[model samples]
Every structure is written in C-alpha cells, then in structure tokens.
Target: MTKADVTGNNHTLEVRDTEQTMAQEKPTLTYFARRGLGEMPRLILVESGIEWTDNRVDTIDDLKASGKLPYGQVPLLEYPDGFSISQSGAIVRHIARQHGLYGKNDKEAAEADMVFDGANDLRLHSRATIGNDTLREKFISEVLPKWLGFFEAHLKKNGSSYFVGHDITFADIAVYNTFYNMQILIPAAKLEGFPLCQKHFESIASRPRIAEYLKSRPYTAT
Candidate 1:
C-alpha cells in the first residue's frame, strides 16, 4: 500500500480502537450493599452484556455528602463520563433505552411503560406489608391475585413470551424482578395460578447472562 493509504488505514484503526474503549468503559451503580432498587439495573446491565461496576455502599451518609444524589437516594447510575442520574425507575428506564430494551417503537414503548408501571405498583404496595401480618395476608389473598391476574391476561393478550412486544424489554425484567422480590418477602406467594406469569419469570431468569447473574449475585431479602 502507498504511504498515504497506510496512514489512512492506521487512522481508521485508531478511531475504531478508541470507540471500543469508550464503549467498554463501565458505568458505576451506586447503591446500598443490598439489592433493593439496584438489582433491576444490575440485571439489565448483565442482560445487555455491558460490564458495570456495582458500587455498593454500607451507608448513604457518604453518598449523600457527595452531593451526587438528586433526591438523596441510592440507586444512582453514573457513567464514566461523569453523567449520573438518580431514582430507581429513571435509572432503569435510562439503561433500557440505552440498550434498546425499552421497546421496538413508540407504541410498544408505551406498552412497555404500562407493564413496568403496573409491576412497580405491585412492588410499592407489597413493600408496605413488610413486617405486618394482616397487611401481608391481605396482600397475598387480595392484592397478588388482582395484579398477577392482570399480568397474566396481558401476557396472553400479547400472545408472546414477552409482556410488550415479541422481544424482551425492561417491562419483562421489571415483572421478573418484582415477583422475585415479592416472593422473597412472601415466601408462600408462588405463581401457582398464573401460568403465563410463572413462565415469563422463568424465561427471563433462564437467560444465559441473567441466569449467571442470579446464580452469583449476593443473596439479599430485599
């Protein structure tokens, strides 16, 4: 090759290498030592095949003092370029969008949001029952049936393995994580009646990267 052509090829290779390095830079997830809200983002990162740093904190005092938290909360996702966002739901959505796991198009994205919101509603309501006998019982007997039935019907209506479109999205991840958390809190609450929900949960869990994550992640009740 001519010298000029060799130089051009070298420049192209250099640019490609730099782009790869930037893509490989790991985004750091700042949260407590436990799973809590951090788990969803972690699952998404793993499933997306993105290597990330799980910066678990023992206490939020240091993080709060750092002034990085928008709402003084954990589950802050920070990229290598210093871009950061707080709020568990926002972080989850951001990662989903970044990785094209949000949905296929606007309509499917909205549907995905609907699924995630419904799953989140169940998560919020059920979390309130933590340590309360009557509330927990009511959640198991009443709330679970209501929400899980909705998910089952939605899944059947979609007529696919996913909650939104043909492919997996953050909506599926949200549902899987929600049920995983719920089951931890209420051990007796299994997906016995909800066949589709159970199948979806197992499907996501069995994904190679996600299954590896589930198997190796530190066990946490929350």
Candidate 2:
C-alpha cells in the first residue's frame, strides 16, 4: 500500500495504513527519563496497544547531541519512517484520535477539550509552586480544593465515571495523570472533598492496560 504524508508544526509524518502488518516497526517516543509531560502520551500509546519505542535521554546535553528533536524538547513522538511530532498535549491528542479514544462526536470532543484544558491549568499552577514550601502549602490548603471541587462537579454533571462520553477519553487520562502527579508531589494532600474525582481516577487507573503500565514504571512526579 502507498504511504501518505502529513505534516504538523513544521514536522513531517509518514502515514501508513495502521493495519499494514503487525510486524511493521513501531514508532519511537523520545523524552527525558522522567514521567513529566510525557506520561500521559505514553499512557495513551500503551493503552491503545500500539507498539512504540520509548527512547529516554538522561540529560539536555544528550538530547541536543542527538540532533533528532525538532524543538529540542523531550516527549517527541517519532515514526519508524523518520517523521516526528513534538509537544506533549498534541502527541496525546494525536494518539487518542488515532485510537478512537478522543471522543465520540463533536460535542463530546469539545467537552473533552474543556476538561483537558482545565486539568492542564491545575497542573501548571501546582508545578509553579514545586520548590517553594510555603507556596505549596498554601496552594494545597486553598487553591487545590477549588479546582478539585470544580472537577467533582463536572464529574457529577457528566453522570459517568469518564469525563466525556460513557467510555474512556483522553480528557479522563489527562486529568488522571495530573491528579497522579499531584499526589506524588504532595503525599499528604487528600482528595476527600472530591469523591467523584477520586472514583474517576481509580476507574482510569484500573483499566487493564493502564494498570499494567503503572506497575511497570517507577513512581515519578514529573
């Protein structure tokens, strides 16, 4: 079969029929050795059952030396045919769309985007307070509850365990990953006020593929 080429963000992608053959070489994902922004995309890839290479570089020096990255950023997803895509959220959306895990329709997709954006905002806010003990404490005591309460309300409105539609979506994965990182960063912080969100996290975590991947990797906040 002929291969099609698609480009994104100044990068080229060789689009071959995904059903070509199971023996076809898997794509490669390059990132720092830590979970950080790459974790959600990795989770999507793993849960989709797509075979991919996890290329972990330990240092920025090593990454620059490789000359394979487009933006010199970690979490770059590269195809076997030399095409690659950068940016964590984009990579996660690409994989989710490819695997039919993005959403069911336009409305669902929009809802998913809403949840993803909200989760990302929370993640950024939490990360900004990382090294400062006082800021982190204040964030946990005040800011965290507001965001968690918002998520809890959204989950209740959706009337399902997933953030969008009845099935798992990238939004659920995104929020879950953020929550997972928050727990890692602040072990004492509890989700008691957000029971629905807590259950939602557990639901995503218990997925067969996700559960296996979670067990295989070491605990990391980044």
Candidate 3:
C-alpha cells in the first residue's frame, strides 16, 4: 500500500480501528481487547466488509457495567445487543467462520485453527514478558525460534505462501499478527536464521488492509 493511503497516530491502534471498522452491518461483533489475541477476531471484522463500533473496557466496573454479555475471559465477543462470547480462539474462529476466513470447509477451517492455535501459543508466551526485557529476550531468543521454526518448516512442506492451504485463513492472520506484532515490540535480529518464519511474517503481514492499518497507528498496548 502507498504511504499516503495510511494515516494515524500509530500502527497499532490504527490496525485495530481498521479491522474494527471492517465488520460491516452484519452480526456485529463486540470485542474485548487484551492487546493480542483479541486482534485476530478484530481482523475478521475488518476483512469481512463490516462496519462496527469499538468500545474500550478498562475497569472491571467498565467491563461489567458496559452491558456486554458475560465473558469468562477475553477477548470476548458480544452481539450487537450485548450477548458475550468468551475464549480468544473461539471468538476468532467464530468471526472467521462468519466471514469465510475460517476456510471453505470444516477440514479447511480445522487446519486454519491449527495454525491459529500455534499462533496463540506464541502470543501467550510472548505476553508472559509484558515489560521485562530479560524475559522478552528469552522468549524471542529461545522460545520464539522453536515456534517460528516449526511453523516455517510446516509451511515449506505445505508448499504455499500461507499457513493454511492456498487461501488466507484465521490461522494465517493469527500467525502474521502475532509474529509481526512481536517484531514491533522485539528486534528482528533476535529471530535471525529463521528465514522462513521471517519471510512468512513479512508476507502475510504486508497485506494492504494490515499495512494500511500499521502505517496509520503504530502502537496500541491495550
């Protein structure tokens, strides 16, 4: 995408808004953000050609009184009227299923979930180090290599650019978002030698929808 096409204070929040705005006039997904997993479902909303609203939930009071349906955990999904659905993977799969990001069939969707689940593992591991540089380094230097390497080998064996079959799926999006988002927070050099992982990250991450989103808003922690 052209640089002029993207405009925002930062790539992070802008991407969130980009996808959040994408969920058009359909089932309307109300999401709770943990700054990571929630992003996948949000991407589905944006990619689905739907326009929806974003509501920030800060305090527990804010969460409960905001009138969202019960979510055992976030990122939660709420219907237009406020019925809530919990579980990050579930929210993501639901949105993907609704928007066709899950894939063409059940088996395809399951494959998508496989990729997505791997991405989630990486993200949760990354989150363990919130602001601890030492821990973050350990995650990126040690843990991430194993994870990214595994996926890269899998993708190579599959003989495709994406994580799933030929088409894009929530799995691809999840891995891309998690990997790229981590890069935003961590140095790429830390992931050196893992070329396939790095390549897949750059490719899936460069989508117009996503790049445009990044060029607009570069940072959003929560």
Candidate 4:
C-alpha cells in the first residue's frame, strides 16, 4: 500500500492486484498532501473509467522509498515496468489523448490545448496570490478583466456552453477545475458579479461525473 499525508492524516491507496494484473495493468498515481495538481489527473483517470490506486505520499522517507517520482515531485504517474512520469499537465494530456477526452481530430485537439493551457496559466498565476490585495489585482486587473475578457471573446467566437467541440474534453475539465479553484480563492461575492465566469462555473459544477466526484470526495470544496 502507498500512503500520503493529507491535512495531518494518513491517506493510503492501493492499486489493483499487481501479480494478478496483466502486463497492461492500469497505471498508478501519487500526489501531494494538497489537491488540484494531482487532483485533475486523478479526476481524468476516474473519468476515463481507468482503474488506479491513488497513493498520496506523505513524508520524505515514504516518498523516497516508493520511487513514484523520476524527480522529487508529488503527482507522478507510475507506468508498467516501474517507469514513472512527472509533470501534471503532460500526464493528464496523455491520459486524455488515450481516452479520447482530448478531441476528435487535430483541429479539435488544438482548440482543446488552447483552453487547457490557458486555464492552467490562469491557475498558476492565481495561486501565487496570498491576500485581498493580490486577489484584487488578480480578480480586477488580471483575472477578472484579462481572463474574463478572454473568456468572453472565446465564448462569443466559440460557444458559451462549450469551449472546444460539441462534446466535453479535458480542456473544459481544465477550465472547470480553474473555476473550482476560483471559488476557493476568489470571494463568492466577487464571482457572483462575473456572470460569464459564474455560468461557466455552474455548468462544470453540474457535470455528471465531476458533480458526482465533488459530492463523494472528502475535500471537494477546496
């Protein structure tokens, strides 16, 4: 069993039986005590209907012993024959491609890439803020105006209901995760004023798989 520390508690996860499993056994993942980075990948894995044991690594000793990382980062994908892969975006994209969650064609994939990568950029920068001041700059100058403008334009040009094709993709999933994070980071009252943002947020929140996952997960609010 592989275990990780989450909020001072031990969270252990076990993959499918290693021996009884075939050479094509589903890959495994490990993540930090916190969520989001690994959370998205875990969500992708689940949405893909793939089996995995989520190992939430806790201590340096435990992490070092597991060899789940090619480098010392949480949220690495352990493949068959013990080949571990890092980088959350790369891992998630790979899974999306494999599971047809990326897009139908090259053009669709390209569009999905734009949304996914753009949302990721938004998330990384937003997480850097620590308080109301930073949040204002982000929500007002940066996130609100910049992202909202971009979002409005994209939705106007594309479609407000969906980012990519006629169906859902990791791009939408990525953007939804950003909105999910925004609820925690950005004040609810501020978000309420952003109608487009709020619409996007609600649409994702209502997604069957994501909504169900949010309901079932222990710390979904964050």
Candidate 5:
C-alpha cells in the first residue's frame, strides 16, 4: 500500500481483506497517548512500509485497568495471532529484524547494537529527569553533552549520516528518537557543536514515510 493509503491525514489504517493483505496481518501497537518509548517503534513500522494500528491509551490508569498487557506497560506490540511483546528495546529490535533494518552483517549488527544501547542509555537518563526543572536543566547542561558527544563522535567515525554503514539501521532510528524526545522535554537544548548528530536526526525525520508519519500524528509530549 502507498504511504497515503496507510497513513492519511487522520492517521488511521484502512482495513483490507485481500488474500495477500489478510495473510500479512497488520500488527497493533499499544502505547500511551504520548510518544514516549513507542515512538521509535512506530517510526520503524512506518519506515519499513508496514501498515499497523496505533492503539493509544489516554492514561496509565486506563492501561492498567485494561489488564491485557503482558507486563502492565505501554508500548506493547500485539500481533494478529494474539501474541504480544513488551519492552521498548525488544520491540524495536524485533521490528528492525523483521524489516531488514537491523544491519547487513555480523559486524554491522554489533555496531548497531552498540549505538542502540547507547541511545537507550541517554533515553533513560532523559526520562528520569522529566518534570523536574532543576534536574532537567542539569541533564541538558551536563549529561546530554556527554551522550550527544559520544553520538557525534560515532557519526563522524561512520563517515556517513547513518549510524551504521551506508543504510539507516535500528541504531539510527534509536538515536534520532532519543534526540527527538530530548527536544520535546528540553526545547531549549541545542546541538551547538554536534552538527553530525543534528544532521542525523533531520535525515531520519525527513524520510518520506517518517516525515509523513510525523505530520499526520498528533503532538504528544513524553
């Protein structure tokens, strides 16, 4: 299906019953209304050209009350067969592998793993500081630089816009989402010296599918 067919302005999927379409069942991603950990996986799905469902929960209480989540957490991936997977990292990796975005070979996959883990580290730190203005400021001033600098160095070493080799991998998406969420949390935070990191984020965000998804989806701070 075309990007327009899968994700129109309303951000809703059109159900189809063709044999091929039915065989390739659309997965459903359950997450909070905010982007949070689910955004990257959503981006992966979009970039991979998969048409899926976005099941957003209005509140944590509502999610807990549902009692269908395997781990009582948002960002759960549920398949058509009623199987579900939890944890943001696992879900991202799963989708990446399914979509051939994990990496090209063993060496590239290892590099991708390193970059993805590093991005997750930064994400954890940023999430922990949310809602605390003082802590958030300190993170933006001190911690963010360390992580962003590491990413900048890696991007420079890679000698390309992507995090791993010539193509965009899960690591690239992870890093982009990390920076994207950081901007949401700390809008004033700037990539003063990290031109590569800035470019990396923009590159992923500007992908045709990713850009359309961003434009269609509602803004939600996490």
Candidate 6:
C-alpha cells in the first residue's frame, strides 16, 4: 500500500496494488481536497469500514472533460461495477442505506431525513459567512444560536446519542459535520447552554472509527 499526496492541496490518497485488491473492487469518491460538501460522504465511507479510494483532485477538468460527472460537479461516488451517483446528499444517503447507517423503518428514515435537511440548512448558512466579516458576526451571534437551539431541542426529544433511532444514523454524522465545520471556522464557538448538543458532538467524535478518521484526515479550512 502507498499513499499519494495530492499536489497544491496536500491531500493524501490511500492507494493499494490493483492486482492484490481487484477482487474487493473498492469504491472511489472524487472531489476537491476540501471538507466542504465532500466531508460528510467521506465520513460515512470511513464509518462504514469499507476500504475506498479518497480520490482528491485540485481541478475537475479531467472529470468534466471525460463527461462522467452527471451535473458536471465533484463529489461523485463511483462503484467498481459502473454504478455511479452525483450530488452530495444523495451520495451520503445511498452509502448510509447500504451500510445500515440509515434508519431501520420508513418512519425512522423520514426522521433521519428531516434531521439531515435541518443540519444541511445550518451548514449552508454557516458556509455563506466564510469571507464576509459582517455575515460571519451575524451568523455567530444570531444564526448559529437559532440552529443550535433547534438541534438542542431535537436531541433532547430523541433522548439518545443518535438523531433518529436507537443507533447512529447518517443524520447523526450530518449534525456532527455541521458542528465540526463550525468549530473549524470559529475556534471559540462553544456549545454552552446546549448540553445535549455538546454531548452529542462529543459522543460522535469519540466513536472508534470516527475518532481514528478525525485524527488522520487531511487538514482543511472548511
């Protein structure tokens, strides 16, 4: 096995000999070397414990030139059997469904979807504040609190470490990703007054596989 570091981004890719691992046929996720929309899917892949290729790239020219991207975008998930999908949300859900990280029943699945959407809403708002100090201040002071309050109440109602059912789901990882990105953007942001949210974040972070991925994942600003 060899790890290839992507140029300009310093992102690492875990490579294995094709002759040795061809039978397993590992999946590959192609995306820019950033923890933006790609992060949650990557997290789900790691948590699933399936050896996959983290195919990070500095540009999508090759992919676009190849016309393989359905929407001409990154974050494309491709299986060895020619099954491929685009869009981050769908990719995350598909992987979750395949690995039992999705909720068990239809109702539980709906609940998980709801939580995932809500977390995505927060993520979008937070992302908009990236370079604008005015928006950033407003987001930190007003927007974040509102979203955190919702998550706090949601977790309190669930009465468990997970967001949907008894076990961890994609929704739990989505929430964790949102909080993780927020902390990356604002180092001083705290979950004060939202104990459930705090505990939830810590709980997800401490999961065995997740902890390992967090420790070794390539550093990114967002």
Best by TM-score: 1
Candidate 3 on 63-147: residue-level lDDT in tens?
Answer: 5676553653456666654455767677777777777787788788778778777877887787777788888878866888788
10 residues in a row with least lDDT, candidate 1? 1-10
Span of ten consecutive residues with least summed lDDT in model 3: 24-33
Runs of candidate 1 with Cα error greater than 4 angstroms are: 1-20
**lDDT of every model, 2 decimals:** 0.88, 0.83, 0.68, 0.73, 0.84, 0.87
- Residue 168 miss distance in model 2 (angstroms): 0.6
Model 6 TM-score (2 dp): 0.87
Estimated TM-score per prediction?
0.91, 0.86, 0.73, 0.78, 0.83, 0.87
Q: Show pairs that collide, candidate 4.
A: 4-56, 4-57
Ranking by TM-score: 1, 6, 2, 5, 4, 3
Off by over 4 Å in 2: 1-20, 60-67, 219-221
Model 3, 27: alpha-carbon shift in Å?
5.1
Off by over 4 Å in 6: 1-25
Candidate 4 Cα lDDT to native: 0.73
Task: Output the number of the lDDT-best candidate.
Answer: 1
Predicted structure 4, TM vs. truth: 0.78
List ranges where model 5 is wrong by over 4 Å: 1-24, 59-67, 131-134
lDDT of 2: 0.83
lDDT of 5 by residue, 48-106 (tens): 88878988877667657777666788788888887778888888888898889988998
- Predicted candidate 2 versus true structure: per-residue lDDT over 1-222, tens digit per residue: 322333332222332343454335477787778898888888889888888877776776766678876787878888767777889988988888988888999899889989999999988878878789997888888889999999998889889888887998899998998898888887766788688988998988999999998898866546
* CA lDDT, candidate 4, residue 123: 80
Model 3 segments more than 4 A misplaced = 1-34, 72-74, 81-83, 130-137
Candidates in descending lDDT order: 1, 6, 5, 2, 4, 3
